[model samples]
Target: MTKALTPGSIAPPFARYSHAVEIPAGHRLVVCSGQLGIDSQGDVPPDVEGQTRLCFANIAAILAEAGMDLSDIVRINAFVTGREHLPGYMKTRDEFTGSPPPASTLMIVSGFARPEFVVEIEVIASAP
Candidate 1:
């Protein structure tokens, strides 16, 4: 299992994520590549909410292949095209991560490999 960490020496997390995570010994890690909003049909959603959901859906598919789920995620790196997508991102993330979410980093980038893509998410997961 993965444990969320919040050291008293440091300020608490500002949002839904922990400051760090501790994965138990003897566990292996599954690091996922950045997941884009593109669906199986090779179509990118127009809205941030749909794209955000698709990103997680792609991530979930990858995790499932590894015999794990979102609950095993320890860290997440999100790259968004604009800051306006924060609220939608947070809500969608909460839908998947539940309580004690993974350590998270949000980056506002100018663009992505494809102009139609609005968001990309990458995760690091623990596996026993």
Candidate 2:
């Protein structure tokens, strides 16, 4: 199992995430591509929270393919178009992340491949 690391010498995480994670040896790793909010029917949600949920759903599917689940994730990299979308993204993200929480970074980016997309998420997972 992975260990959440938050050294006492440093400040605590600002949000619901670990500062870092220690992945043990002999574990297989999976690095997923950044996933947009579009659904199977090619529909994109207009709201950030909706989009964030879809992002996690898409990530779950990818992890499933490798015999892993959301709980196996050790790090997360997320991007939103603007600051206004931060709360919505974080709320939805908390629902998907497991106990001990994954190391995470949320950034405000100018945009993505499409203008309609408000959020994007990518993750790294490890399992023995």
Best by lDDT: 2
Worst 10 residues of 1 by lDDT: 92-101
lDDT of 2 by residue, 7-122 (tens): 99999999999999999999999999999999999999999999999999999999999999999999999999999999999999999999899999999999999999999999
Name the lDDT of candidate 2.
0.96
In TM-score terms, candidate 1 sits at: 0.95
Any runs in candidate 2 off by more than 4 Å, and if so which? none
lDDT of 1 by residue, 54-110 (tens): 989998899999898888889999999898988888888888894578999999999
TM-score, model 2 to reference: 0.99
Instruction: Rate residue 119 of model 2 by lDDT.
Output: 98
